[model samples]
Target: MIRLVTLQSGIAQGLLWAILTIGVYITYRILDFADLTIEGTFPLGAAVTVVLINSGMNPFLATAVAMLAGPLAGLSTGILNTVFKIPGILSGILSMIALYSVNIRIMSDKATVAIAGNSIKKIVATLFPAGTVSNTLSTTVGIIVCAALIATLYWFFGTETGCAIRATGNNSKMSRSMGINTDMMTIIGLMLSNAIVALSGSLIAQFDYGSALVNMGQGTIVIGLASVIIGEVILIHKEHNFAYRLFSVVFGAIVYRTIISVVLTISGFKATDIKIITAIIVAIALSIPVFKEKAAMRKKRNLAMKEGK
Candidate 1:
């Protein structure tokens, strides 16, 4: 049996990352854009939250401000891509690079900003009787928050504006022909995506680490991509409803974290090997569908030859 504390921690971490992965899913899978600005926006959220909390602001309010900061980052990328006519990938890269400096400025040029008061985990602990497991409470909070977010996204994506955005992603030329403002839809999608990513960063900083580090968001995009791919691979045959897809993304994050925990528990496995392992897992997940298709083609060809014989 998996250890209770370890399981709780893994679930909490997975839930936090699930939020980020959902954001990635919007841009990568929904909008069909490889927006790399998430790498900057994630840390930007953490920086904003830590700065506000250290200034004696309420944690919840600080998190809200952090979420707001995310849209601005996304808008910057949108303007670069839509207004300035830069390529989608390039626009995201430019925005991400600029946000690195912005994040440092937000932290007053400090590489790390620590929260001065009780961490969010401690605050949640107060809600339970003394001696109750903090990880369990935090994980519960994460689950509730994630469920709310997924529900909101599911509803939003079903609306007229949401359909327009989906159409924009599916085919920009077709969307434009249908009188949809494809550029505007793209901007809105990016803004919403980065906002969610920032929100996740803020929550993770407050509830888990109580500190915002400049490099904390490095490799975040990779993890997000990995989660998205893993979820798609696992749920390939399931109904593709928006809510189900969103839930699958969250589940994927949980599975990814659990795998990492299990790997760490193995003898001779070091923490430094995590990125390489994650990359391998992502590569394998991504290749599965291609391999399956190739095998199917070969099988069809063999059947045709046997029938001809």
Candidate 2:
């Protein structure tokens, strides 16, 4: 029963992170750039949301402010990369590094804040009244919100600007020739991606009944990347429907968390080994294509041997 609860908790955590992974996909996959600002921006959102909620601000409004902050972080990186001619990856690294201090300031140098007694939780308690049932309701509400946001994103990506963003990603030189401002497209793409990321952070802070802490975003990009790769692995031979691909990311995140929960339940491994496990999963996912090629070659060799016999 404890193991089952652990598994459920993992799934819940993963579902929350699925939003961040999808945000990462926008820049990493769609825009073809690394926007490491997500590391700082994610925790920034949480911090801002917690601070506002603690000061008696509206929860929804606080969440909105947090979401807005994420895009601005991306914009800073975008300008650094595009305007100053810095490499995209390097610009993102610089921005992320800068955000470390910014996040510290935002959190008022606290390592962690206990949001368990906050108004957000109180409001939910009032509504649900039941103990575990309130937690369930909060999770359900969050899932619904995430689902709606994902659907809206799917629709937006089908728009003209979104198509241009995709085109710029596929070939910036061609997009330039077509008179689309590739620089602007990059900025817009990063902005949108980080907005989603921050929104995820806000939801996480509120849901977990915790305040944002600096460095909370460590390994976040890797987790997101892992989710994407896991999703791809599952859909390796599946059709290329965009909606399916998007949902697969969410599914992958949940599965990844499920795996972690199972691992954590095993007494042999320390909780700190999560990063090691995450790296292993990512390495395996990345090696899949090479493995597939080797398998094909072996099959061909066997066919030749049969013919010779």
Best by lDDT: 1
Model 1 per-residue lDDT at 165: 94
Question: Best candidate, TM-score-wise?
Answer: 1
lDDT (0 to 1) per candidate: 0.89, 0.83
Query: Tens digits of per-residue lDDT for model 2 on 28-113?
Result: 88999977889888888888888887777888888899999999899999999999999988888888899888887777788775
The ten-residue window of minimal lDDT in model 2 covers 113-122
Per-candidate Cα RMSD to the true structure, in Å, reads 1.6, 2.0
Clashes of each: 0, 0
Compute each candidate's TM-score over C-alphas.
Answer: 0.95, 0.93
Candidate 1 residue runs with Cα over 4 Å from true position: 1-4
Shift in Å, residue 187, candidate 1: 0.5
Prediction 2 global C-alpha lDDT: 0.83
